[model samples]
Structures are given as C-alpha cells and as structure tokens.
Target: LRSTTVRNLDGVFELMAQATKGTRDAAAEEGAHVLAEMSPKLGSAVERQIGRLEADVEHLLDEVFDAQIFEGVAALKSHDNYTFEHSVDVAFYGVMLGRKLALGNEYLKDLALGCLLHDIGKMYVDERVLNKPGKLTASEFRQVMRHTVLGFQLVRQMPINSPRPAHVALQHHEQQGGGGYPNHLTGTNLLARTPRERFDTSRMMLLSELTAVADVCSALSSDRPHRAALPATEVLTVLRQMAGGHLNRQAVEAFVSMVEVFPVGVHVRFNGGKYAGSYGVVVKCTPGAANRPVVRLLFDAQGAPVPEGVEIDLRKLPDDGELTAVPEEGVSVEEYAHRLAIARH
Candidate 1:
C-alpha cells in the first residue's frame, strides 16, 4: 500500500510537467498542498520507517565514501519543474550524499532541511523568468538573484519550525566566488552559520552543493525549460573538468559514483567480457559484483551501448571456456555499487 501511495503520488507529477514561465507559483502552492495531504496518510510509522531507511541508506554510503572518499551524486529519471518534485528529489539526494560524507546527526538534519528549501528562492522569481525558454538579460538575471532575499523574507514571516532550510533558501546561489549577488560576498562569506565543524552551513550547504550537482546534472542530463538533457557520459566529463575551481572535488567524486556511471537495472558494455559481457543489475549482490550479474547477450565489452537482456551471471567464467583470471579493465566498482542501490530504489 505504501508503495502504491508512492506510485500514485509519482503519477501526480505529470500534472505539473508542462510547467513553464507562468505556472511556477501555482505549481509550488499545489505541490505544498499535495505534500501536506500525503504526509499524514503516510502515517507516523511509515514516516519513521522512511526515516530509518534514509539512515540505513546514509550508513551504506558512509562506508562507501569512507572507503573511497567522495561526495555522491543523484541519478534522477525525471525533470519536471514542479518545486515539490524537484525539492524532494534534491532532499533524497542530499541525504544520500550527507551519509556518504559521514556528517553528524544535527548536520544531517540540516542537510535534509537544506535539500528541502534550497530552492525557496525560486518562489520569489516571476514565473516568466523562472521558466524562460532562453537566456535572460543582465537585469533579468539580477532580479532572479532576489529570490534568495525573498525566500529569507518569506521564511522569516512563516512560523515554520525549521530555520536550517531557510538559510539554504537564502544562500543556495551564493557562489564560491565573491562574485555572487546580494552581497558580493566571496567563498565562505556567502555561506550560513551551520552545525558544521569548520565550513558548516546547517549541513544544507553541502547538500545544496549536492543539490546543485544533482540539479545541474539532472537538468543537463534531462529535458528542461529551454533544452534537452545531454549525454550521460558527457555530463560526467564536464563535471570532472569543472572540479576544484568551480565545483567541489569531493562532491563531484561522490556524484560520479552515485550515478553508477555504469548504470543499474540495465546492461553494461564492459571493456572486455565474454560476448563482450552485457549484464544487468545484480540485485542480490553487493557493490563488487552482482551476485547473479544478469546478462542478456548482445554487445561486446568495448564501451558500446547495445541491446542486452537479463540472463546468467557472466562473472563466473563459463564452464565451456576455462578462464585464466577475473577480468579487470571495465566499469568501476564504485559505479556498480551505486547502481545496485539505485536499482533497489
């Protein structure tokens, strides 16, 4: 039934899919109402269960991150403009990334909040500007920056219990460079006083970073108000090159692993596996290798995408052909792990 609820709610996502320059506010308000209705029906136990599941998800990521040291990116399949839809996706992704970073409880809570309200600023932007088909003029862009201020003002007005997200609402666009608007503040200057140890920002900033990564990755990887998403591998490459100076290195690394560049539930084109090794998600296995790495023989392992089906575990070299040793040169193990998690989701 809970799964049914999620499915039904996901169905509602289509209603707001055509959203553009004029329907943002209505979409936000409708989304708010929809969430209000769904939260209660989900029940306290389900809520707690979801919460614990989130924790477990975080735990798994923490171990993965500790072992490899990376931030974690999201692998969203949709890109509708509904604020609630995008916000929830970002929050889920943020929490997942927070777990990977081994963030503390309070910070994790803030990260969750940050993920929720990181886009509160969008509420203030005109529907036209928010959904413009093309680039905006300098002045129009400046008006967009006002969303952060407007978001902070709106949150201050509300008697909402949480302030952590409100802060993210205010600082989400404040870039690493002092060039960011509102207060020409640079680097940490644009950040908020968070539950962080050093560069803390209610933990949301980090999630905001994750959100930003996911938001852009999803946008660039999917159809948007102005254009269609780009190639998945191209998206990864761009992020890789933009690391350090423009984006966070740790965050980028996690994101690459998160998407499981070697996507799950789908067959992979290995570097060199028998029949070139076309395999599906190994739901029963861990990150290393799918317990029964399903395969649907079609393509060779030369990085070429081919139509493959779910079949047998190719990891166990065939009895007919004696194998020398386990093959190496293919998909990254980290990608395999993240894909497994995504498949289970």
Candidate 2:
C-alpha cells in the first residue's frame, strides 16, 4: 500500500510541476499543488485507514518540507478556495514551528499530517453552511463544531505510528483552560481525553499544542463564510491574548517567532504623518524584531506614486519613526506593479 501510494504521489508531483511551469518558484508551486491534492487524498485515506496509507501521508510531508513550504503559503494569497488552502497553510505553519523547535524528522512528518487533517471532518459539513456569507445560528455553529470529534474518529481508524494525529484532531479545540468546546477539558482533564488511556499527561504533547496554534492562525488569517479575513498582525495579537490561559504559552511564542508580526508581502502604513497618506509593502521581516520589517514605500504622503520606490528598514529608524498601523486590506504584487508602471510613465 505504501509503495502504491508513493507511486501515485510521484505522478501527481510530475503533473503539478508541468502545470505550474510559469511560476517563479516551481518547487513552491508544486508544494501548493500537492497540498490541494492532499485535501481529497486525506478523505480517501481516512475511509481506508486499515490499508496502511500513513506512509504515503508522510512522504507528502517530506516533499512539503523540502519545497520550502513558506513560498507555497505565499502563493496561496491568490487562491480563492479557503477550505483547501487553509489546511495547507496550517500544515506549512505547523512544519515551520516544528522545525523551529528542532523536532526530529519523524515528529515533523506527524505534525504536518496532523495539521493537514485537523479540519478534514469539515468535509462532512454542509457546503452552504460552510460558505454562507452571514452569521451562523447557534444550531448551525454546533453542527460545525462537531468536526473535531468527527475528525478524531476518522484519524483514529488509521494505522499510523503515532497517536498524536488523532489526539490533535480531538484536542486542538480543547484549550489550556476548561473553556474550549466539545469536552471543555483542561490540564489533566485534557490529557485524559486522549483516545488511549495510558498516554502520559505530564505535559500536553508539543505537537497538539502547536497544531492548535497553527489552526487558530490559519483560520483567523483566512476569509470565512461569515467574515472577511483578519490581518495577520491582528490575529497574532489575539493569539497573544489567548496565550497562557487558553493556549500553551511556549507554543504561542514559538508560532509568533516563526511567522513574525508582519509577514512578508503585507501592506502597511506608517503612523504619525511619517508616511501619512501612503502605504508600504513589507519585503522582509527580521527574526527577533517582527514589527520592524524592511518595507518598500509605494506612495508619498500625498498619495502620489514615489516614482522611485524607497525601501526602509524600520529597525534602523528611531523609535519614534516606526510604523503605527497596517490597514486591513493589503496590496497585491499586481496592484503594486500597476502603480509602479504609472509612476514610471
């Protein structure tokens, strides 16, 4: 079964490479394509877990890590299907956080698979409810919340080496406090909720905690049926607020450090008349100083094109000269190129 799955995936990768020929980073493009493919493959694997398909799942994870998945995550900015894209994004984030913690290759593979399938139960959900543009009623929301348990059931059937994936499906929604849904279990209670009775509860597995962080970040940063996507900065702020009590503090901190406050390619505005009416595009983010990224000024204070793009490293600026705000809507590369062309003419 493992060999057959690998052969199938190899063919998929070749097709993806050919399909994304025009992309600047073909490996990244292939990563996104692989993610998209996994969405359906996961559902199939869950249906036939006794077939020992976990090896194939791990193989895909290996490819994702090797492809430098962040580029694929960036490529997702143009994709419209939030459901499939969100799973891939969470997997990318989970793998990144796993690497940052220096987890072994085996653990990283499990983490990637766990994050990718965390929301797989949502496949059973009603598409109208999932895609509705209005608020969900209490009943509808309850139905939606069942995905955790449903996902757990599916993953539990798989003959995987680690039980962490199934645990993640069930407990990713469970919080540090007893406030989370389904079971509202916390501390010892949370650990006890695992499928197996004998697993250690000394500390929640970092995989489960990290999956929660990735899940929250991916969901909040995405456009939902009920609301527009929140800014990454705002989502991180929300995560910080949830840390310690609702989320694992160390996991949250690790996630923040991995993604930074202002990720690359986001559009931001300088506060206090520094770039008053203008906007800047984040080009690079410093590891420790997330807020102080390197940006290319796209317009002047009066909203005219800068003609010559002016790049700034916020870390080099005085404390008082740092950017104050990032608008809810970010500018895209195409939009920036269009503006730059107008400025040039």
Candidate 3:
C-alpha cells in the first residue's frame, strides 16, 4: 500500500460520513433507493450517483497505505439491514483490496461501483425467501440464486462507461472451478457469461475475482437473515479454505493482508492463560502474523482493571511461546470494567 492510498482512504471515511450524515438508517435507505431504481432503465440521476461513489472510492485508493482508515470503516459495521450495509461494506473492502493490489484509479472506480451494486438484482428476489430465518427449501434456494442473472440484466442497462459492473453481477457467485451456479460456467465457459469486449478467454478478469472476494467477506461478517455474523478470524479462515478451488487465491490473499486476521480494535484474550486471564484490545495487526497483534491489556487475571493499560506486541514472542486463541466474541469494555470491579473486592 502507498502513502497516497492511505490518505485517500482517510478522505473516503470523511466522504462516507458525509454521505450518511451520521445515520446508518440513512445510509441503508440511500442504498435501497439505488437498488430500487435499477429496473427498466438505470436513468441519468442514478448513473451520476454511481459515478460519484466511484470517484469517492478512487480517492480512497489514492492513499492505500493507511490502516487507520480501514479501521475507521470497520468501526461503523454495526448497521441494521443486511441488504444495504452489505453493499457499502463490499465496496469498501473491494476498494481496499484493489488499492493493495496496485490497480489503477480507473479500474478501482469500476471495481468499487461493481461491488456496490453487485446484489442489486436481489431486489427482485422474493422478500419471504430473502428474509427467511430458517433454511430455504430447494425451490426457495433457486429463486434466491436467480439474483445473479437478474442483477446482470439490470446493470447492463446502466450508462456507465465500462461493462465491468454487469459482468461482476453475473460472475461474482461463480466459483474458480466449474462448480458454481446459475450458469455453472467453468474455465472458458465463464467467458461467455460476461461481455466479450471487456473480458478474454485466457482467464477470469480481476474485477470479477476481486468483487467475489469482497462479496464473500462482507456477507460472512454481516448478520444475515439465516445466520449470525462470523468473526473476522473465522471468516478469513473459511476464505482461505476456499481459495484455489472456489475463489481467486490472489484476491483472497490481498484481502487478508489488507484487513488482517484479528483486525484492530477487536477485544481478545490470550489463550492458555498467557496473560493470567486478562483481556486486551487489539491496537495494531501485523501483516503475515495474522493471530499476533499489538494489544492494550486492560484487565488482569484477578478481573481487575489495569488502570494504566499495558501494550504488548505479540509478534515479539518466540514461535513456540506465541500467544494463542481469541474469544468468539471479544470482551466488551463495560463487561470488562464491571467484572474487574467485582473481583477487586
């Protein structure tokens, strides 16, 4: 990541804050509106809005070296709707990874736009099936799967200069091998599903591959109608397991590097009683050392607040003695303080 990219990402956070004006509902409703306008024709107003979003994302990529901006966006992930928040999250993650991959500004813009609208076709999906809390019947599942094709059709009508958004909408769900759905396109077969002018038979385009990674990440980190959100560590582990067979390995790796396994600000406890049952907040994540981060120790083994917190860099530990394990859901500040006060007596 470059310094300029980091600066741009900082700007993106400010832009996103301004876009929503401090309301998650407003942000979600704005995204919902965009998805609603996708039918029949894309219209000039929608196209311009998409363009503005693209430009904002491009600014985010212009300074990709900063982790603070990524952490800032991560802090805002507690949104209400899976539909709207998922789109914005995917766009943010996609652009972050794209910048890490050193993609040009124009390509980043297109990738961000594609990710933001990848699920626009889901607007046509049956609400009952989309919002169902239980396992879907086979027929219901099929209706859900149709969103990809529907999304492709809707995005194709947009006046955007590139066809990448439509292509991504069609191919994001397709796996690396011949196993994925709707079209089940594998290898050369996948090429036929996207526009021939923008894609080649030699390989899957990076835009689709990047968007797929972002889609999976955002969905896994979100609370869906069917399941609770998975932790970031678990999500990355699942993505790594799918690499080479179901996902693009390079894209997955880039995502892992950009977001890290632990991510900053998540509360965690050392495994095996390494810190005497103390809980800590992750302050910085070292790339490649996914499990080890610089943590600010806040609670002691006796369940007492540390008062002046201690910062520990887990990466410095010897390989044999490296800290292990993070709680599925990390300790909350309030929970920690309350528990500590009770134990002190």
The lDDT leader among the candidates is: 3
Model 3 Cα RMSD, 1 decimal: 9.6
List the candidate numbers ranked by TM-score, top first.
Answer: 3, 2, 1
Per-residue CA lDDT of model 2 for 258-334, tens digit only, reads 56555687677776436555677888876656667898887767766665558988777756354544554655556
Q: Identify the runs in model 1 with alpha carbons over 4 angstroms from their true place.
A: 1-75, 78-82, 160-163, 184-208, 268-345
Q: Which stretches of candidate 2 lie over 4 Å from their true place?
A: 1-79, 123-128, 187-204, 260-267, 272-284, 288-290, 296-312, 316-345
Q: Sum up the clashes in candidate 1.
A: 12
lDDT of each: 0.48, 0.63, 0.65
Clashing pairs in 2: none
- Candidate 3 residue pairs in backbone clash: 4-62, 4-63, 5-62, 5-63, 5-64, 6-63, 6-64, 6-65, 303-340
Tell me which of candidates 2 and 3 scores higher on TM-score. 3
For candidate 1, write residues 1-345 as lDDT tens digits.
223323332332222222222434543444323222321232344334334434443553344346343322223453454445565555555666566556776677666655554565565457788889899998778767766665554433333345655566666655455344455433432223444533543222554455566555655655667876665556777777755545556676765555544323443443343553443333222243322234443323443333334444544654322111122334544555565556556
Ranking 1 against 3 by TM-score, winner: 3
Give the winner by lDDT: 1 or 3: 3
Give the range of the ten consecutive residues with the poorest summed lDDT in model 1: 319-328
Give lDDT tens digits, candidate 3, residues 18-130.
Answer: 43333333323333244334344534555555555566555556544366665433422332456565676677788887777777778888887788778866655668889
Each model's TM-score? 0.54, 0.63, 0.67
| Rank ordering of all candidates by lDDT, starting from the highest | 3, 2, 1
